[model samples]
Target: MTPDLAPQGALDRAWQRVADREAARLRDLFAAHPAPILPARAALARILAALILLGSAALTLLGLWLLLRALGLGGVSGGARVTSGLGAAPLLLFTWVARPRVPRVEGTPLPEAQAPQLHALVRRVGEAVGVTRPVHMVLSPDANAFMGLHGPRRTPVLGLGLALWYGLRPQERVALIAHELAHLKNGDPTRGGVVQAALNVLHQTVSVLWPDPVMEARAGLPEKLGNLILKGAALLPLGLIHLLLGLVGADQQAAEYRADLLAAQVAGSEAKAGLLDRLHMAHLLDSALHKQRHQPQRPDAFAEFRHMLDTLPPAQWAQVREEHARLRVRLDGSHPPTADRLRVVQAWPSEPLLTLSPEDAARLDAELQPFVAALEAAATEEYLYRTSG
Candidate 1:
């Protein structure tokens, strides 16, 4: 009897050791370290604005000088001075003042009475890791949800799309939110958004300088000049630079797996296991929606090949649908291919899931009450896939 009791005690201690080790690893992974140093987005924006100002100023002066030269003032100013110096400054000012501002929409807040359930979920998970409740949550039709800075101090915005929720079970949905919160805690969303915004501005500037019209002039002085500037700017290697950003972005995506691990540890393994399946299902649903909205080209191979990969053959539409079904991952506009994300999540280690402490669970239940009510009241809107120009 003494020997039997000794073996049982040893087994219990061994299991406890394993659990401790796993928890320690998770804690380190989720620890809120200072954000990784990257180019400051606002600083970069200011720098870009300054460069534009200087360039426009120089161009204006050059145009002025050109105008003077045209009137027999400076060195051989050949060709008509079609551009006006005064006009150039005003044009620059206009561009500075007015550009299409990316519409900033706030996440819809669940009613105060309803905030308990969702809030509790976030609170339990957040308090467990020592972070604040998320600022707000949004529901969109697209199979997408992103965490990002909503305001000063980089508040977290959780866009939990309907497609994502529809595809996932309750447990999986909780895991997804947990994963997003982890991103907020890790500070990746704000950092990534900054990098993304900078890249976007740079790409926009390049496009403005020498668009396709210059290329279409079919070989002349203006064409040559435009080509020269375009070629030089091409040195920026937008594709390669974006690839590097994608890698950093992928690192953040991998961070999703780490977050899932945390969720499983704090919430339970059932939530974690369902993640991959739910993600794949959501991807499929989104792809189907996309196809329905965009009429696929006829099945002619030539037509399909000639068009962008996105424009599949109407005949081969069935095939395309089949391929997408087999793929089992969402094709995100920005993130890595769906298949790849699924693979990463699938590879994550499996361990016994842990539930939040009783107090935390109760709090989570309370906080999520409002969201649950909203979810119940919300009608299942049909997915209408449309791209706005």
Candidate 2:
């Protein structure tokens, strides 16, 4: 691989342009068939992911052999023994530290006991979307709803960011819930175990192999030379991570569109589009919360933001939509562009399969009353909406 010497951001921008083109291609490709399972690419991603971890495991085996030989199990002695032992330690440590484990779900827990009505509301939406498993819920202070798998059982988890949750009307919350739950059935790439584990392995390996600039700055000539060697070594895995991202890019984009399709089926098409409109105004939501966070006297951040969102000028909506199309920034780097997602959501219409009433939503809110105060307000993030642009 050629080392271009461009900073990482420059590299990211270059690849991102490549990614944007791919997204556009996939958006068109999926129009006739919105969500194909993409078995071929999925297989390739799985194989690549497996090889990454297997490579680590092979290194760990080598470390074991060296350790065994150092202990005189193979009758090796003295300088050889000392050298083998020294080398064995780091390799063994690396494998242990980086071994795949189920990642913990973020945000504070909202156990079924603590929020049973809330849990029930999510389940109602889940069943309508065809997810049969028991659901767990959590609360965050962000402006997003999420679907994550938790524990060894891979129990489905639903996360509600109170800011976004409170901002939504009862029916809108049904659309939000349905949209997220649909990800489980829509072939979300991150939900796949083999490929996700491999991604985790690749990320861990890259972090270890990539030379730290801070360390390089403080190094002597000998250490700098070692870093140079490491910098070269890092290219293999770094390039692999990029390759995997490219492989999954189009499929993941399709998965999101497919999830929107399912959301429209579960919640009405108009409601789903309305939820997306709120997402497009995420920056405004952040601005409202930021204003409250800095106020000398405290205010109900959710109410302040909700009022602002409710009264947003029609021109501002048009402006954000224009900005989205012009800039091509994704909600997250992983998502298809917001403008495109909105276009697809509006184009494909469906009747609501189920609905959440205001009374039911109130019951759910009452169950989550304890978390309301803590989760309602969030501090501003420079990339808060940038992350979800």
Candidate 3:
């Protein structure tokens, strides 16, 4: 694409190589300095992200004002007004699509009264990680966990994936909590309003331009042609996304390693690395969960998840790692490659700073019992619907 007529697969193949190389480079950076400062490029990316957000907002407003002036005050002819409206329609649609949004965590909300034990563990992990406890608790069905600032008030919320929780050891569970809590301390600039808004704007633009295969099947010839043109138009936004990734990729990775460092500091580094390793095997859990649709009886999804992990062969584990090695991380992904993360945490090994004992973990499990079956049912239903009929 650099010469403007490059081979079709060249860019994708090259990027995969770049990803592999970049991960090793970042691994070396972590090995050399366990604690990292934000690079100058990341600072520049922040400014550009802010500009992109502001510029889009400004252009939308300006276009709207000019259109309204021509229509109402300029006393334009009916034909002229219609023409102007048609010309402004696409811009207006993009403005509406790309409006700033408050993204909410989609999960069952866990009140403090209902989940006192879980709340207590959250508080303890918060203290261990040197951050205030997140006020809201969420029970997600997926095999991932996150803690983030949400809403206008930026109230901290912790969402734990029940499936992932089922598979983790007690100390590894502590590591999961610590990792999320550490995002509050780590300098992940994506947490800021400007960057988040900018990302959302770009994401919405891409969504509008990307030709959905489901819809494409029903499209007429003219519509299909339009989709092709729109797909071509997508190149600019995609390039901007790549630019954003290039500038902030290493810097964002540094934040992740920093958070991993905190996790290692709180929960044993070995446990932290173990958690990352388990996370990489998430697809195996996903496959098993989806298979519940064909089960002879209603299966206990949590038990199935744990059993899958327990029974996985050594060769299967290596294959899983190899499969993940071939994958690439895009800008929108939550974390760097798991192998790179594992390397970072493994390099700085430590014993448990905050352990979750078997007894306490059992108590916490009891607190989650009511939500467990519901989450598993919901997750199984979702996986079945998504993967098949």
Candidate 4:
């Protein structure tokens, strides 16, 4: 007869079983949900469309010049020359569209030496997810974690939001890191970079070419005619681009689900579910508190958030949970609904892992204390400036 394992040992074993099952389930999901090919095809279509537009504009300009020369009206240099220049303006507009710079997000870097424990945790998660460690870590005021490529070499940067870090349990924090690391493993950052670059170009092109009614209202007849020409060039192409982006957006949502599944494997299903549920509850509670307090100005919004979470009535909390469960998947959003994520986690076996001791929690808090004041100060300053402006 075999001796029975301890409770914690048994729990770990169960989680491992669940993880193995989830891996097989993921394979099946991939088979069932074939990758969306529409977006890639659409991107190619947009490139071709842009080339055609340029070619047509060139030919049209040449035709007008030739027409003037044929009709023996070539002696009218000023008007004919102006017409030729104006006819070629659309091509110049396309060049401007491609040149709009992508803006950088601002955050202070937290060096590994400054937060070794945090770095250790990140490293652990990255190893579990089979991805290289992030090249840099950043701290921001928002309640989220995201990874992206930075600089000329496109090194990976992992951003940790202080609010979310403070709010989550140790295991849940691991789940979050694992989720971000999974994005790197899944090649999402590189793929998204290409997709986003294309979309940015499309957006700039549309804005430049789309007629502004207010500007048109104040313009003379010649300016109005120019605006009309710009609008005519942009309208149909912009519509097609938007339609393609919608399909790409769907693919992005699918990526989020895949990331969540991978995170569940590393952090266990229970922790992932708890994290999602708490995030949803936090959103609901924060919204309710803002309404009740008339959006009270606070020196530290995270502190205010903690107070609200602690003070929320049990009855109201239950109601919020109910609302969270019933929430529908929002197609317009990048991520799937919280309820759906929770449902996926619920199907997996679960076990608690990496519970933080008081000493551990205190150590983590101590490491973050120095940065907290600065982050809070920045947040306060931004809030005041925005409200006043």
Per-prediction TM-score, please? 0.50, 0.86, 0.86, 0.68
Ranking by lDDT: 3, 2, 4, 1
Once fitted onto the true fold, the runs of candidate 1 whose alpha carbons sit more than 4 angstroms away are 1-91, 94-114, 189-194, 206-250, 283-389
Candidate 2, clashing residue pairs? Answer: 331-388
List, in order, the clash count of every candidate structure: 22, 1, 0, 0
lDDT of each: 0.47, 0.74, 0.78, 0.63
After the best TM-score superposition of candidate 4, give how far the Cα of residue 54 lies from its true spot, in angstroms: 11
RMSD in order of candidates: 16.2, 4.7, 4.2, 12.1
Query: Residue 198's C-alpha lDDT in candidate 2?
Result: 76
- Residue 377 of model 1: what lDDT? 24
User: Can you give the lDDT of residue 365 in candidate 2?
Assistant: 66
Expressed as tens digits, the lDDT of each residue in 1-389 for candidate 1 is 00112224876667445433433332333333212233233354445444544554565466556556556554443444334444445555534432323435454555435555665555665665446755566655445566665554445666765445544545565666666777666554324454444454445555654447645567788878778877676556355334434334424433555565565555455666566444433435434444433665433211222233334445564554344333311111123333333344444444433343446544644454334434422322233313332
Tens digits of per-residue lDDT, candidate 4, 275-354, equal 78667655533443344346755545565665666567989878877865544332223565566566666666555343
Candidate 2: tens digits of C-alpha lDDT, residues 1-389 = 11223336976778656655766766665555555444367567678878887887899899999888778787787889989999889889877766777866887888878877777777888899998777778888777888888888888888888778877877788889888888887666657577788777777776777777788889999998898888887788778877776666656667788888888888888888888888877666666666666762335666667777898899998987786665453212467776677778776777888888888878876776677566653334433545557
Show the colliding residue pairs in model 4.
none
Work out how many backbone clashes candidate 4 has. 0
Candidate 4 — which residues are off by over 4 angstroms? 1-90, 100-103, 189-193, 210-234, 282-299, 329-332, 352-358, 381-389
